[model samples]
Target: MNVPSNRPWPRAAWLTLAGVVVLFFIYWSTVASTVAIWRRSETFAHGFLIFPISAWLIWQRRREIAALTPVPDWRGLILLAVLGLAWLAAEVARVLVIQQLALVAMVPALVFTLLGWRITWAMAFPLAFLLLAVPMGEFLIPPMMEFTADFTVAALRLTGIPVYREGTFFTIPSGNWSVVEGCSGLRYLIASFTLGTLYGYLTYRSLKKRLLFALASIVVPIIANGLRAYMIVMIAHLSDMRLALGVDHYIYGWVFFGVVMLLLFWIGSFWREDERVKPAPPVVEYGWGLPGGLKPMLAASLIIAGFWPAYAAYVEGLAPNNLAVRLQAPAGRNGWRLVAPVTDWRPEYKGMDASLHQTYGKDGRVVGVFLAYYRYQRQDAELINSQNVMVRQKHPVWSNVGEAAQVVELAGRPVTVIETRLRSPHQRLLVWHWNWLNGPFTVNPYWAKFYEARARLLGHWDDAAAIIVYTPYEERPENAARTLQDFLRDMLPALTAKLEQAAET
Candidate 1:
C-alpha cells in the first residue's frame, strides 16, 4: 500500500495547473477585488483562508484524484463562456459581487476543461467550497437585523419589561438599544456555515448528515445571536445601564458566538463517520504522449475565457471620459418659492458628477430637495450603491427609523418612491426618494442597475440621479407625507426637465 514518493507529474496535472494559472492572470482584477474585500471587511476576512483550505482539502484526496485518468472535456468551454459573459455583464453594470461570483466559478470550469469530469467530480466539494470566499450575503443584513430586534424585544416583553419598538430601534426602561449592522449576526452565521460545512465534510460520509449539519450550523448562530443580544440588554438593565453597554458589548458577543459554535460542532461530532482511506490502486502508464486535439481545445478554452474581459474593456472604452453635468435647481411654481435650507441634513452620495440641494416653501409648508447626479459611473461612484444611503446606521444627528416603498401620484401618474422616516432629537421628517436612470425613474435598486447596464450596452449615455424630497412633521407623519406629495405634484415636471437638461449637457 506504500505509494511512490517521487512519482513524476502527469501531463493532465501540468495542463490543469497551467490553465488555472492562466485563468488567474486573465481575471486577476476580479481576484484582486475579492482579496481587497477580505482585507477590509472583518466579516469576510475568512475569505483569505478559503483557497488555501480548498487546496489542502484537494491534497488530502490526492490519491483518489491521481488514480483517475484525464480526459479533457469540451463542455467546460461552454461553461467558461457562459461564466465569462456573466462576468462581463456584471463588470459593465459595476456589480462587484456578481463579477466575483462569475470569476470564482471560472476556476472550476477551467479545472474541468483541463483535467476532465472524473477528476473534477472527485474534487467537487473542494472546488465548490471555494465559492465561500465570495463576499456575499450583505443583502441578508437588513432582515437579520430586523429579526434580531424583534426577537430581543419579544423576549424582553416576555420577561415583563415594557418595550417600545420603532423599526430596528427600541427603547426600554433601562436604556435605548438599536440593532445596527454589527449586531445583525451575519458574521456569526457566515462563520458557522463555513466551519460547519468543512467539519461535516470531514466528519460524516452521508450527504444527508452533512446537509443537516450544515443547516444546523446556519440556524444555531442566528438564534444564538438573538439570545446574545437579549442577554446583553438584560446585563445592562440589571447593572443599571452600567455593564454590556461599552466595548464589553462586542466582547461578550464574540465570546458567546464562540461557545455556540463549539457546542454545534460537539453535537455534530456525535454522528461522525470518519473518512477511511483505502489502498491506492496500481498506476497506469500513459507515457509522455500528448492526447490528440488537446492543444486546440486548450487554446479554445483560453480564448473563450479571455474574450469577455476584452470585449468589456472595449465597451467601457466607448464611454465618454469627461462628462460635464450642470444640475440646476428647478424653478419654484404653484406658490412654492425657493428658500434657504432650514436644517443641515443631507443624503450621503459619494463621487457624484454634480449635486444640488435646495429648499422650497409655501404658506408655512416647507420641503427640501436634494439631487445627486452621475455620468460614466464606476466603482464607489455608482448611483445604486450600499454606501449611497439616506442616513448611516448610527448617525449623530439623524436616525432612519422607518422606510418602505410607496406608490404615489406624480403628475397624475403612479410612481413608486421609497418613503423613509428620519428622526432626530428635535425634529422628525418624512422623505421620499427614487432613482432617475436616463429617462425612467425607479424606486427599486435592481431596476436602476438594469437601466444603467441597458443604457451602456445600447451605447446610450448612462446618466443617472438620486432625487430626494423631505419635509418636517410635528404630530403625524401623514402630514409630512402630504407635504412631500404636494411638493412633488407641483414640481415633478420642472424636476424632470432639469434632470433631462443636465443629461443632455
Candidate 2:
C-alpha cells in the first residue's frame, strides 16, 4: 500500500467538510445575525476577519493537523448536545451575545466529533480565539465613559485647573466639554485586548505570561485614554480652542496606542517560550464511516437547537403587527388636566405601534407625560432601544444627554431613568424617562429583549412601554427636579395602573 502511515489526511478532510455542513445547518440563524451585527456595528467589524485568520492559523500547521486520526470521540457528541441546548435557551431568551458564543463554540465540538481529540487539542486556541469576533463588549461603554470623565477631571485638578463637572459634562476655563461616546476610548480598549490576546497566544507558551500581558493590554489603554483626554483639554486650553480643537487629541490617541502596543510586543519578546514539537508519525488506521456516531448526534442537535426558535416564530406570528395599545387622557387629579402637546421639543419614540404625549399642569408646575406602548417588542418598535431615547443625537437644543443615568425609587421600586436638562435660547426643560418591559422598569436593551423573550416562552402577552416625564423649568435644576418628583408622586400610581390595564386589554 502506498499510503502515508503518519497522516489521516484523506478521511479527516471529508469528515471535516461534513461537520461544517451539519453545524451551519443547526446554527444558521445565529450565523446570519452575527454577520449582520458585524456589518452594522463599527465596534464589531473585526468579526469578518476571524474566520480567515483562523483558517490561516490552521493552514500554518497542516502537517501537524494531518498526523491525527479519526478516533470518533463520543464525549464530543455530549458536549455538542449541551451547547445546542444552551443555544436554544439563548434563542428563546433573545440574548444575542450568549447565542453568538454558543454558535462559535460549536466549531470545536464539530471538529472533535469529526476528527477526535488529537485534532481538537491542536486547534483549540484558534477555535476559542474566534470568540473575540462576537459583539460582546458594548456593555462596557457607559462605565468607560464615566471612568474617562473622572480621570480627566482629576488630572485637571492636579494641574491647578478649576473644573466644574455634572454627569459627563464639564466646564473648563476655555470652554465646556462633554465626554461623548467616541471619546470613551472603548475602541482603543477593544483593539488592545484583541491584539494582546492573539499576541499572547502566538508569542508565549506560559499561561501566566500570557495573562499578565493581556492585563497590561487592558489597563494601559484605559489609563492612557484618560491621559489622552487630559492632554487634549490642555492643548485646547493652551491654544485657546484653536489647534487641538481642530486636530486635537484623537490623532494623538492612535499614535500613543500604536507606540504602547509596539512596546508591549517588544517587552513580551523577552520571556517567550517556544512550545512547538516535531512529533514522530503515528501508526496508520483506516476505515472512514459516519464519525463519532455523528449522524445520530447531528440529528439530535438539530432537533434540540431548532425547537425554540421555531416555537418563537410561531408565537410571534400569532400577534398582528397592526395591534396597538389604546391610550387616552388619565383622569384629572389635584388640578392636573391634560393639555395639548404645547412644548416645542417633544420626546420621540418613532415606529412605536402606539403612543400618547400630553402636558399636565398643577400650581405652576407643568409636566409633560409620554407613554410609548408596544404590543410586541421586535425590530424598530421596542421600549429599550438606543434609537428611541428621550432626546435624539440630532436634536438642536439637547445633544448632551447625561452619560450617568439615574436610578430612583419610584413608589418603592427601583426604576432606572435618564435625567437630562435641555437648555434653549428662551427656556429650559428637565426630562426623566424609563422603559417598562412587561412588569418592571429597565434601562438596558439586552434585558428588555430577555424579558420579552421570556414572556413569549411562557405564553404571556409580549407587551412593553416607556414612561417619560418632563417639564419646563426656567429656574434652577433643583426646582425642576422637585416639581418633577412631586408630579411623579401624585401621578405615577394612577398612571402606571392605567398603563398596565392598557397592556392587559
Best by lDDT: 1
Off by over 4 Å in 2: 1-9, 61-67, 74-82, 85-95, 246-249, 276-309, 339-342, 401-428, 441-447, 472-479
lDDT of 2: 0.75
Q: What value of lDDT does candidate 1 attain over all alpha carbons?
A: 0.87
Per-model lDDT? 0.87, 0.75
* TM-score on alpha carbons, each prediction: 0.93, 0.86
Q: Per-prediction RMSD in angstroms?
A: 4.0, 4.3
Steric overlap count per candidate: 0, 0
Which residue pairs in candidate 1 have backbone atoms (N, alpha carbon, C) closer than 3 angstroms, thus clashing? none
Q: How close is candidate 2 to the true structure, as a TM-score?
A: 0.86
Candidate 2 Cα deviation (angstroms), residue 344 = 3.2
- Tens-place lDDT per residue, model 2, 163-255, is 999667789889988887788888888888988988898888877988998998999899988988888888889989886665546677788
Residue-wise lDDT of candidate 1 within 408-492, one digit each (tens)? 9887889999999888998888889998887778888788878777777777778999999999898899988888988988998
TM-score of candidate 1 relative to the true fold = 0.93
